[model samples]
Target: MSLIYVLDILGTFAFAISGALVASDKKFDLFGVLIIAFVTAVGGGMLRDVLINAHPINWIGDLNYLFVIFTAVVFTFLFKSKIAHLSKTMFLFDTVGISVFTLLGLEKGLSYDLHPIIALIMGMISAVFGGVLRDVLTNKIPLIFQKEIYASACLAGGITYLILNHFHIPENIIFIISASIIIIIRVIAVKFELELPKIKDDLFTKK
Candidate 1:
């Protein structure tokens, strides 16, 4: 099939594994692990589809998406010990997942004739909200709500993509550039502990 479809599936699988890993860390049972995996795989995309009124949503159309998540869950189960030793590798995979999701989400938004700015937000949401959902389900604060650069990285990538598309860059090249921007941002942020400033809690504290 098309490269976009391939990337989408790859992102789904990556995110599914990420979710399963989180569940494993939390000591969730098998069913709970599977639930978190599926949620993280499609939570963002489903939110985007619903907002944009995409018919039948994404996974509902093919159902093969479910198989992808199932594979991720099984892989996580079989390789739990191995994966535990690959935390850095998993971080890199998470970057790849968000990068692909951001690009695909932006393109999907444009295909629906949405404004570029709105499409950028859509891209950010698609790249981030799944992870947010995963965090929320795990009883942790969402990364985007923290000082993390999670959503910021997606926004930077989306804006670069919009600018490149406006300049008539080749689609393949644009995809590479955009995805690289996202991953680079993520890598730098995580490596350097770069983060947005949090508002001082004393701002509204009672005297």
Candidate 2:
């Protein structure tokens, strides 16, 4: 397989594992865990494809995505005990997955001649909406709505990729740099507990 395909599979598996972990935290059963894993793996790609009119979306075109997600669910279940103790490590994995997926999504959007701004938005959605869906289904507020720098990191990566691409940088380099930027940003933010300002309810109170 090509390196791109390998990276894609890795990203998919990472996403699935992250989703499965969340489901486990919520005390979901095997079926629910698998469902979350599958959605987290492909939900963003499906949405991007639909918006770009790239119909017969990616997972539908290739069964390997499903296989990867299932494998991830199984692996996560088997390693649940070990994984539960590694919350920081899991967050790192999740950060990497989101970064890689965001770059892939932006590449796909650019390939379809989408505007750069739209492509950046698509990339953020592709990286994050799956996690949002997973959290919502499990009755938790989505991370994007929380003070975490989640989507912002994805957006920063996406914009960096677009800027680099505009300068005629090679695709491989663009992917690496963009993904690295996201991973670094996420790690630093988590390490320092850095977050955007929370909107205070008092600011919106009627006089």
Residues 1-207 of candidate 2 have per-residue lDDT tens digits of 276677678778888998898898888899999999988889988888888899789899999999999988998988888876876766666777788779888878878988889888888878888888888888888878987898888988888898998899988898888889999998898889899877776767887
How many residue pairs collide in each prediction?
Answer: 0, 0
Model 2 stretches astray by more than 4 angstroms: 86-89, 201-207
Please provide, for model 1 over 91-146, each residue's C-alpha lDDT reduced to its tens digit, 9 standing for 90 to 100. 77678889989988899899999999989988888888888899999999886787
Q: Using Cα atoms with residue i matched to residue i, what is each candidate's TM-score against the true structure?
A: 0.91, 0.89
Worst 10 residues of 1 by lDDT: 1-10
Please state the error at residue 98 of candidate 1 in Å: 0.4
Best by TM-score: 1
Provide the overall lDDT of each model, using Cα atoms, as 2-decimal numbers: 0.88, 0.85
